[model samples]
Target chain A: MSTAHTPDRPEDGRDDDPQDRAPEHGHAPGHDQDDRAGYKTDADAGSVDERDEADAPAVDPAAENAEGGEPAARVELPEEQQGEQEIPTFDLTLQIRRYNPEVSDEVHWDEFKLTMYGTDRVLDALHKVKWEIDGSLSFRRSCAHGVCGSDAMRINGQNRLACKVLLKDLDLSKPVTVEPIKGLPCEKDLIVDMEPFFQSYREIMPFLVAGGNEPTMERYQSQEDRARFDDTTKCILCAACTSSCPVFWTDGQYFGPAAIVNAHRFIFDSRDDAGDLRLEILNDKEGVWRCRTTFNCTEACPRGIQVTKAIAEVKNAILSRSM
Target chain B: MSTPLKASISVPRSKDLEVNGVKYNRSSSRRNNFEMYAWLFMRLSGVVLLVLVFVHLWVNLVSPEGGVEAVDFAFVAGKWASPFWQVFDMLLLWLAMLHGTNGLRVIIDDYAERDRTRFWLKVFLFTTSAFVILLGTLVIFTFEPCPAGADPALLASFCAAG
Candidate 1:
């Protein structure tokens, strides 16, 4: 569970402001600035200046030579290019499902219309509603770009990370509907009680279980052996795939696709010793056989993990009685 | 004036039912991958079934014998007289029965939510399938076009003449 940490220092080219924390997971650098500038400028004159500054040369030797080599790059360009570089914005109506268990017994839809650019995500729309229009809007989100696995809600009746789904991908002709994921109990607006989801995940030991004498050096595993279970490693435990399952909805006790996916991660690992034990656990009546292969889990995975195929391989492993 | 409630995630539940902790009894049959093999068999047999079915259709319905009208008892008798045709038909009968049965099993598993319902449905399916396959195989191999019994009037006109 120990992650490799790179200590923060002033010389590391990272900003000191906590608000400007570096993008650690999936988002490219400078995306936060683009989104912020998009919101602030509303595609106005301010955006044009920013674009012009971005495109202008950083080290212009000819201009510097002309000004006695005294840093001509510091001089601002003429305002003509600034006029052409405009950020486009359009109005989008987000129909969000609102629920507060203490306040109400039923879920309700609240619509918020906001101006956003093409590059903005569904998470941005939720933020605009929470920060500007209604302070009472409640939801869970961290690492706003797709990594934290939080903010997995139903967007247009499909499970997706609010941060991962681009506004452009949705049909703007209709108001986009957002709700809590199906099959899990909704505790509040867009947030389900994740205890049951995590409970199933806990049943399958997600970590490596190695036995025998501790190796003096690192345990050697071939590239081909590592490649066997490579696809299952990308799981962020978002529960998007699991929640979308028809089997999980039908039988709550059934270990859903996510748990099987995690089991596949270690069950096929060449270095692990508990593969047989794990296989035996999955061999239960409610195990791999319960997967009817309707392919809802595969389609719902945001990480693009081949969930159904992994389950099939696990089924094969159980059959062959091999790891 | 009110103090802010601490924002903390809920503690995870203990794994009381993990492998070693609980007596994990399997409710379903212990046999593994009968379904797995069944799934794979469907695909592999489907390829074979495609070939066998097309050839059988061409010989009986389309080729020489023009259509459904040509497929009388005499035509069936002529085909079954040859060992090659009898064996061809036996293979076809077994493959088609097994393939169709596996497909129905998949459907039952998907649509039938109740275990007892699925079990009974599959029981009916397997029984009927076994009956058909056995009966078809028996008739294909042991069919006597002209039986020794004295029932010439009840037999096909060609069989009675022969």
Candidate 2:
């Protein structure tokens, strides 16, 4: 099942063209105010400021004791504590690559500046734009807390999940550049055809194989044996690691990091009987040898799988079997 | 672009392939330490080359009577006369060729797309490497510093002195 959480368009906010605005480093005047933050005009500004002060603790005793009761230190703690669900709002420009095959001939960038919470994720900003500011903006996201790997995109030139990257973690001084992940054919705005990636995943045969009679109880495994391949078990098939790899970018047929990692999960499993077959599959010319050990996959994996290390292990397995 | 793939729920068929009513491991003819030895040789030779190359440079250039300019026919002839220097030169020649050939082979395997292309490229590489190695070995061992009938003026100063 696909969970593409794209909102339907509202009629009124569609008229204000984001393209007409200056691409300068100022507040996104009309749109950000209209969206989530509900940033007020000059007349209503006082009430918003009053509400912020009321929500925050008037004084932090630890800050006063640690800093000799400096007034500035007391003021900073409230802002620091704002990230704890209170979400201090800040102006951010979400520079998104927009493409519609039916409408536009080529992809063009569209910037939406909005007053967003420090607690807000990149997906939240996209949701705000689609829900309140402009309805035509589209992206894919599911299990918005990063479990489902649907929202993998290049945020600031690195593969990351939209739901995983917080606005506070980003450099708000520059526009947050959100584009589709590289090494895949971008189908539309912030979405690529994942079939090619999944095709590679399928070729690896990521599952267990036991060549024995059905056990009355589950086949027992020692804690150490389970721990051996435990790191690779977190793969969500996100393609973040694969798309980030320079080798996979150059050679599409190379079984990318995710596939090898999944293969490693079974290859090292003590219960699996088909490991030799898996190793032989990976021993092809376009297999583990193609990995340059760039560590880009290790960096991009949201589930924190040690992708390069797993690839190395698979290479060792092939080496042992071949020799 | 084609349609985005739906999430996979199909059960893994890990036991599909069978032989003679029983499962069997895939057969592979290559059962040797060729790659393992090559990889080990690269690392081991790298450490040895680091010291040997630096020391050879120092003796021939920096620490000699004159840096770089002291490297003439007489300088090489004098060094090769010693058994220590001959063995040193031989090790340098062998290690460098083997290390370099293996490194290039890795690059070829990484970049070459077609099977025949990779095979031919590696064949060419191995052929050239073997030629250079043999030629270098012959030159290192059979090098003539002084000929008996050579003109005295053209011969190295050692020949005239001896």
DockQ score of each predicted structure, in the order shown: 0.11, 0.10
The list of candidate 1 runs beyond 4 A from truth reads A1-26, A29-87, A98-108, A117-119, A132-138, A216-224, A252-254, A283-285, A289-296, A315-323, B1-33, B127-131, B134-144, B147-162
Q: Compared with the true structure, what per-residue lDDT tens digits does model 1 show for residues B79-134?
A: 88889999999999999999998889867766676678999999999999999999
Highest DockQ model number? 1
| lDDT of residue B2 for candidate 1 | 23
lDDT of model 1 at residue A268? 94
Candidate 2 structure quality by residue, lDDT tens digits, B1-162 = 222222323323243333332212212224344555565577789999999999988888899776898787778887888889999999999899999998999887667655578799999999999999999889888989897777776566778877
- State the C-alpha lDDT per candidate: 0.69, 0.69
Indicate the residue-level lDDT of A323 in model 1. 25
